[model samples]
Target: MSRGAWRDRGAWLLAFMHAFVAVCVLLPSAGVHAAETVHAQIAATSEQVAALTAVLEARLEPLVLEVTAVEAVDPAAALSAPPTEDVARVWITLDDGGATAIVLSGDGARGMVRQLPREGASDEVLREELALVIGTAVDTLRRDAASLASSAALREELGLSPEPEPPPEPAPSVEPPPPAPPEPSPIASLPPLPPVVRTPPPVEPTRWRLAGMAFYEVQGFAAGQIIAHGPGLSLGLGGPPLTLGPRFELSGQYRLPAAAENDVAGLRLHSGAFRLTTQLTVVRSSRVLLRVLGGAGLDLLVIEPFLVDARAELMPRRVRIAPALRFGLDVPVRLAGEVSLRIGAGMDVDAIGTRYVIQDGDALVPLLDPLRIRPLLSLGVDTTFVGHPAFGP
Candidate 1:
């Protein structure tokens, strides 16, 4: 072929890929994993993947697109796509008309939606088509990457390990043995069949319905002269993918052995807090869910003191609302229906870093100066409410 012929072929190829991938880019957003559905799986050889990836990146770079590569396999068995596509998958399906490039998009929302198939494609041609699929995924990723960057659950859900299924084992070859004496005196009747039972799949629940969350947390406070550890109880409400919206929580904590003077000093510390939090799901699957959360809270802390000596004297205890910021990881195991057992681990940082206050005469002083970040791990239950709560008409 002449230089002009090659140039024409290249131009046509580019135009064809652009048209093919354009369909994927324009599809409607379905689940919250709209962008992730495009995070893809491909069926091809390692060599084919390398060649395809190079071509895709070369073309996608000008458009500033990025895509992750799942491991490639032998192209011979790359025709049938995976059984389920939690994320989009790309492969070539065969018909009478040679090879057809297909992209199965959506996370079950649009179940195995096929892209515009290309016909009579070669290795080079198929590479171009697969690259186009990733390019389309990159387009939507731009819209969600910022919000998803902080979500570890979303990243884990997109775990694109496209390990090729092992090929079917070949049947063993056998030789017939010589038969001796054959005696027949048996009934030809077959045994009765077992009863057939049908199990319907559970209705998939939407994540953010009105969800209630409860958990136990252990809070710690320590500094120079003060060392305190306390158990806390937390309850929260919010929903519609309970992990996406703001949840209001009320929690209370208590620790013993506080310092007090003059007559009474049993030294017990009590604290209550109201927190507003939002959780970002990093990954959500059939059996488990992972999330990262951020929130702000005000702690209403009260101190009770016990005097060691009979002659000790001091004013009343002090109460204050210390502001704090908290970060957490919530991992839940999805139970049967709309219920989940949640295990949460969190850390709280006091904004002002001041320690617990003690009563000295009529003034409040730092009993545990320079407070530290509190760490807690909790087990809880989460459930979604039936109807949306309605405020006034």
Candidate 2:
């Protein structure tokens, strides 16, 4: 078979095997992982939203009551006073713009109030408006009992019926039986009540953290290509704004390639390269992460082409581009106070160099095509130096 045909067949076989293994095995596991990841993120988001909404609701409760008819009935009483046995229910509604009038009626009382939200102000304004609306009605009732009576009369005139009164209790019968004798003394009565137990207040969790990482790499190219070995470094940032997870990262690495030759085919010389990488971690847990990284840097290549006889072609250094891909675990170490470490493994791809001369005739002929690909394996570690403290017990 021609050389091109043989290369294409080998490539197809490799691709098919990779597909088979991935579809039958890796894909199923990955699908489960994806589902779990989505569930976790949704759960975390829901928890945060719930907590925030609770706080807002609690703060707004007093304000809502203050502006409604419930407070107009008795606004002078201290907030700490025991609630009256006769409860009055009131419901209030506000427009989206926060500018509107509301009418509330319950317990034979009815009132209306206007509400407004000031620009560049907090919800405190809402509370203020609520007080003003309810306070006006209370003042009107206190200053002039006649006005209150008049309002009640006006309601009656409008055919508004008063609330119904509760039924009266029945009188007791005559000629009752004699009372029974007392049975127990204080000492013989029920056992003394157990001492009231007290519980300590709950502690809040720590909510800050930082992470760091480093790695080592080994790479080899296809036949007639070069091989390289090197180390890489990475720094990561994480915290509450990023939803209490690690995301931002910066990394750099250097690699050295080895040279070799085949007797039947030709000679090859490897080159050295340097690369810088950056990644954003989309999702992360204590030990694992789903990340996406991309970066471009410089690479240096040294060439040694093969000749027909015994001599070979040599060329000067050339500059090229380098790119990488990463996927791995970031384990933590807690040897130092509030400090941690990370270790990981991933794959990388880079452009080695180009080809120019080939052994053809008396003089070396120029070979136009020169693109090359390299496959790499890497290991890394990181230390948290300037990061926030992660949440813990």
Candidate 3:
């Protein structure tokens, strides 16, 4: 109807068309940017999963990273697969001796391994250290990839081609040369030389290793209604280190006397044990050695009893013999040359339960009951000496 109205309507339509065109142009690029996220697959213990993921997120800043927890991550498997820009895998493994983290790049061609400390540091600190290592590896891989891509792009832009291999220099023409004159032979041919006979030196057998260990241990046993604890000392001698079979060891242990008292009566008990065990090495490395041991032992227990009443006569001490079966695990961490710090835990089951009774006005009352099971923990040092072969012809 009016000229001003018509002009206003045309301007509004033009603005709408331009806005629509701009939105269409921006949407695809935004989607592409959002899709370019780095997918991180993490394999770690259940306790460490959350902390590791959080630390990684913090360290890999500016790059969009999506972390997923998995049961396991195999670096070899990751390396075998074709690498992509958006995927990475990390694995954290822990043992009694130490910890380690392995990182595999999205490009199957690269990977990194980091050894982490197993002690002294807080969990947060360790996780941060791991994250830092993984971040560095990923960044290095991406930077290399970017550099390669940029180099390729530059080469294409410059329209450069690979230099053609120089035609293998035409093999030099081997010209035929004139024959030379022969020289004179030696005078009076000597008798043919005698055939030489060679003999190999005798091979030496693998030498045996002798190991000695001195240990301090704490032992726990249930006596009556209370648990009795005592300190013990042990000296052990171990046989050769066997490659295909378990090694053998013989140890003697003596436990100091410990007393458990009750309102009615008190008792003091001590024991000595001799054990012969077979040790099968499970994990052996430069830093640590782990072994599982099992064996049987003979125990001599001495018990002394006293009555609260001053007039009551002191009961004579009694000696009991017990056969015990034991199973244990030990780890020795190398501290210096030929010496290591050893820690062990074990359980012993007694074959015979000895019950002690006190005479109380013709009615025998149980003063102490037999301990059927005992638990032991030990700490000590181990030293090894390699023996030389015996002198023989």
Candidate 4:
């Protein structure tokens, strides 16, 4: 296009743009004015309602109001017009029985009971309710006063009653139990005797005893040439006492040898014996006693040789007897405790030859010379099921 024509069109477009800007700016101011006018109207209505509410309240109870104003810079100041208003309302209903009072403002939209009526059904009903409440209060007060009066009367009566007398206690008395019959002495009941009581008089107590021992021995002339004399268990018994008021007892004992003799080279001598004994119990107490024992017995000895070549042989299966003596103490910790432990030591004097003899190499030799006089010591625990209180009557 030509420059002149283009310039003319540009100018026309500029003019139209300026007109649009002007319209946009003016339209906002118009709308703001309209909104401010509406708000002012709302404010006026709120004030009128508040005023009317105050009037209703005053009629119900008394009230008052004061108003004042000030000025400030505002764009709406130029557009300000006279204050516009409309009336606001409130309603109240009061019923005393059925005839409700109807005091109201001119529009019937607002009112109050500034004053109540005198005497109708509603008035009488209200008075009656009030009377009923008052009567209940008066009745409660009368009951409280009557209770106080009754308490005072009770106090006066109690003060007039006589006091009671105290009770008396009885005296104690003494009485003796009837005398028991006397028991007759045993001698009074016996017939005339001829010097002695005979029938062996009476035995004070029965007696019992035990005797035994154990031994281990190895004999050899040099090292690695020893033999085991196998271990043995033996026991002896003493019977009841004899004449002279418990002087003697009959006793016996037996022993057996064990099977394994550790000796690997020479003869292993294992011995067993039995003896008959007599004992005397020396009376010590109703439940305790001491005793001395004497006895004689027989024994059997077996000699076995287990050679280094694994061969074994048995020699002289012999029988023999010997005598022994025993002395010991018996202690009873408690008469009826059911348990007792006795400890004793004694000696056995054996006449060596009667037992066994062997041919060692060339000459005859006593196999077990019986040790002549061997000492015996032992401890034993015994239970007397018959004598203990738990077992006795």
Candidate 5:
């Protein structure tokens, strides 16, 4: 309410406004000075540029260094430009010989040239080496700038005149030394060593092979008009093939009994066989094998009759054995590892013929006629193992 009090309030407000305006104007300039910037100009292939930039950034991450990629018409001109206090410029160039890196800071320009390794090296390795060189140069520039700042501050504190120092003259480029000549052989003056004796590798002795197979077989008896099919197992032992002779295998097979029935008389015919065979390998390769087989065996046949008519009299079951001769061709294809799929077709000739019949009242109805020839088909898996002879070296 008093005049002196109002005048005092106005003066205080004016002073506060002037201070706020000063702070607003100076704060941004201080922030801009505090933040340092690094610009990188790469003059190399695209692959080199990408590799160098990524590795350089990773190496400088601990320093919170920010790298900005820039394109320059002349990298030399960029490197030679006047340096700023808060900014650094790096120029990297790749050539056939190696890489060259130049860094410019407040202190001046620093450069490094690295030669490629004499031995052939990959582009990735070369990029890493060049990136390391550039990183070292940048670190040196930072140290020099920090040292100059400290020296200037110390001089101002001592109240001495802050005199500017001229930039140091650039050092003359030095060429890399030429490669040294190869050393002379120590044994050059001595008589030539005895001709190196080379021995031939020993030949591997032949080994016997044991083979086994489990199969499902189908046999058609055309003469008797019956089909019999069942599972069979076989085992064989064979020697390796000779240069001019076929490989031989002696095998034995036993087929389980399988049955076929006649619809009219309800007569069931069951048959099985046991055979001894000798197989000769005609063609054998890694992928496929062919063999011709011949053998002799015994065939067993059984017959049973069931009649539905009340007056029909069924004959008792009968079993018969007949000698047989077998001839076949087998082909085995390798599936994987030591396993093979075997397929065979064969024929059997019976030595004796026997007939089967059923009795109904006064009628004698034939069930199966004598079987003279039977054709056979088979599919199986085969495996073999090789072993050295028991008594031979």
Candidate 6:
């Protein structure tokens, strides 16, 4: 046996044994003597597909490769350009007896079906055989992904549907009638009640959103003074943009200056935090979206002192990490294309000791104290993606 085959023997044996049990459970016997050949062929095809999928995902990414059911695929999909498209099509088939075929007709390669060893073949043997079978097709897919990483393509390629065209604007809202005058006679009348107006519910937003922002430190209780502004960003990475669904988010903020109170330590502070959060859609409608979110992650603070003694030496540059919890709102209004205007807010609290830093000559000393919760306010632009792969050209 070759070195490559020998190396894969253990993993192949283990996977093959598991595959055998799965195949047996899925493919019942017609008779005690012999199992159906087509069932075995189906099992064979499944194993090969699984192998291909594993390799591709490890080398490329889930966004770069998509697995689909035969029925879900359109007959015309073969004509779409994979390099510029979200998905590519290739075929794998197993024959009734001792043969298998790999068809690379659609994804920018020659339209030919190549044969390989039959089902139940050992992994050691199949590895060598299958490499020759699908190697070129894998290469083609890798090239396509690399070429289109940063292209201005629509998000529909990743199985996402385009947003429907917007409806025409609604008629202007009518004002409620004014309240009637109070009774002139000696009596029975308190001040007339004002007319009531019912407001519309918040709208839900469809599609993934990406945003970059600048923060205004509305309140920083621990620092005792208003923190100077900072920079932040958010990503709507939850699975899909469906209604009332829970979505995952990865977000971050960096406040460049969290100036210490009273300058007691002759030191100032800089803080940054990273979080993974979930946002649940409360409403989505024409031109508006509302979501409520909560998240927890790492908060980092750096203490730097003002060193101004000719050489201006400040000692003991210190840093600390705290557990942070955040809850917030993300409301965005639709603009042209995939862009939106965002007005968002959050409450962030960190569990950290507010250690005071003071200068004793060139050495900096510290005294431990408690910290407080911070409120963050931001205004920024957000954009929806057509399944932007995490890594792109």
TM-score of 1: 0.38
* TM-score for candidate 2, residues paired by index: 0.34
For residues 58-132, could you state the per-residue lDDT of candidate 3 as single tens digits? 887666667677776554444344556564555565434355665555654445666787687777777777777
RMSD of 1: 45.0
Residue 354 accuracy (lDDT) in model 6: 46
Best by lDDT: 3
| lDDT value, residue 346 of candidate 5 | 94
- Predictions ranked by TM-score, top down? 3, 5, 6, 1, 2, 4
Which regions of candidate 2 deviate over 4 angstroms? Answer: 1-212, 223-226, 237-246, 262-278, 287-290, 304-359, 362-374, 390-393
Query: What are the runs in model 1 whose C-alpha is more than 4 Å off?
Result: 1-208, 223-266, 356-366, 387-393
What CA root-mean-square deviation does each model show from the true structure? 45.0, 50.6, 42.9, 37.0, 32.0, 46.9
lDDT for each candidate structure: 0.54, 0.45, 0.68, 0.37, 0.66, 0.54
Question: On residues 164-197, what C-alpha lDDT tens digit does candidate 4 reach at each position?
Answer: 3457776676687888888888899788777864
- What are the models' TM-scores? 0.38, 0.34, 0.43, 0.30, 0.43, 0.39
Q: Show model 5 residue runs off by greater than 4 Å.
A: 1-203, 222-225, 242-265, 359-364, 388-393
Q: Per-residue alpha-carbon lDDT of model 6 for 1-393, expressed as tens digits?
A: 888898799888999999999889755532321311111012334555577456534543323344432422231233233532223334444334443333232233333234575577765455456444454544554455443321112223334454445799999999999999976886547787799998899765434434433333343545444453566776666444445757677767777775543333356777777889887878776677788989899877787766434454456778978787888998867776556777778877765544565555787655324345677776777665644211111
Lowest lDDT sum, 10 consecutive residues, model 1, at 105-114
Residue 338 local lDDT, model 1: 58
